[model samples]
Target: MVDTVSEGGAPRRGRFIVLEGLDASGKSTQVDRLAAWLETRGSHVHVTAEPTSGPIGSLIRQSFAGRVPLDDRVIAALFVADRIDHLTNARDGVLGFLERGIDVVSDRYVLSSLAYQSGDVGMEWVLHANEVATRLLRPDLTIYLDLPPAAALRRLETRRGIPDRFEELERLTRAYADYELAIEMLHEKDSIVRIAATGTPDEVAERVRAAVAGEL
Candidate 1:
């Protein structure tokens, strides 16, 4: 018998995989590794992220650069709007890949909205808004990178790139706490798996691969 516990109305075709965490939790490394491995094994895998590359996604990215100072509520709504475009726009290619039996992996998803909006607005409001935004688009497997706030900060300091607006804040401690709380909420619903992200990128990637492989 198939597991009918996933969201999105008794589950449609395609497996939706999500990697969630704080800014420097090494989610990108793990996601890339997992996608490569899946492709190597003959699985059609497509890897992407939230704040995607669509028109709305471009605006969201610009907003992060301080070019667009939308209110917290507006930011949340914009994320949902961008997600709609990401999921539906034929040019975006996520739905197309999924339709072709390619597993869709994402760097962040609704969880990011929950953490950021909840930190700024409130958890209840974030949840309510997301329920409307995400309607039936939910992940089948959500791998959460569980890392200490201090470690995440260290990685951010050493990484070679321009930091976004959120990266320069002391809010990471609260963000880490919020992610942990969100993980707990997902765990209670049996929809999330926490991978310890306290080691090298390869180590974390292996752990994530193992987690996904076990589920498969």
Candidate 2:
């Protein structure tokens, strides 16, 4: 399982960096920029996101699109399943990349599950369900782009022609509150770095880079 070996014969592992925020918080853009910056420095960077393109992820997308009507518990379960697959898939998984000393920059991870799912199901249940994934794939650094729900909704309306089920202002507001509660409950105050996502992409990317400077 240990694939990375230092020049002095000591074991070393790559960093797992996760970016989390509400929809339209510019996470996707920042993740791309961060990965590109790391690759330019000769690092082996593997970039990915949640609701992966796997079978389970397809179902989650269907649920989001209203093509598949599912209970809250069922939807939450699907998220957990997709996460496990995302980490363990043989061909292209986070674990494989990390094992080979390739750093990972994920747009969204288990925290997204906690924030979004808690809006539908209670926070306690969502927390319990995500316990295993938390222990297994805990990010070395979590950058949370803290954007107000109203601003995020405006950004979504201006940018995306269509919004997903959870993109509405009301639902997003609730999810945002859930994110706050979950962050506290998970005791991520130290590991999770919050950045103001109100500025331009360039400005925000600079903050993101500064936040992860020590880890890199």
Candidate 3:
């Protein structure tokens, strides 16, 4: 197990690292790579993602699947609620693992919310909606795997038949732009890192590893 207690025996909280990017920017692949690398260095790791399997998260998924209809404002609110549960729930929550010294790597977080919902509901509202979650549990590091929307769409085309609503070039492009605003809004307590998510996966992984070295 990764060491949780200091020399004085006080428990040290584990790092919360979140990866953010467009749909096909390889965030999931990088999340797995990062967790494995951390494990080799003796840190226990938990891999998780937003739109969790919880009740609230399930609703969010249904909305995404078009099985449930939701307005932009409602979707934004749901995200915040799901995130609150992810942080403070009594079981299997991010904070629970952090308290036990297991590093938590999430596929996405508040950044995703801002980048996605802001285009429709307005940036100010999205930011305010997430303010509580941001304060509830700030990520130690948020790695943005930066990639052009066109490039990301090309990558998505290789693997999927139908395009997800989120994968549209216009939506992806707006999300890419919104991320800049989101990052700017979060600099105070959020350690945001941008990695050029180009070239091969191995090359991108190297950049991610280098960016995470300070946290090790």
Best by lDDT: 3
lDDT of 2 by residue, 13-36 (tens): 778999999999999999999999
Candidates ranked by TM-score, best first?
3, 2, 1
Cα RMSDs, all models: 4.5, 3.0, 1.7
Better of 1 and 2 by TM-score: 2
Write the residue-wise lDDT of candidate 3 on 15-112 in tens digits. 99999999989999999999999888778899999988999999988887677899878888999899999998898999999988789999999999
Q: Which parts of model 3 are misplaced by more than 4 Å?
A: 1-3
Clashes of 3: 0
Descending-lDDT candidate ranking: 3, 2, 1
Which segments of model 1 are wrong by more than 4 Å? 1-12, 188-190
Candidate with better TM-score, 1 vs 3: 3
TM-score of candidate 1 versus the correct structure, residues matched by position: 0.87
Q: How many pairs of residues in model 2 come into backbone collision?
A: 0
Clash pairs, model 2 backbone = none
- Weakest 10 consecutive residues of candidate 1 by summed lDDT: 1-10
How many pairs in model 1 have backbone atoms within 3 A of each other, for residues 3 or more apart or on separate chains, i.e. clashes? 0
The whole-model C-alpha lDDT of candidate 2 against the native structure comes to 0.86
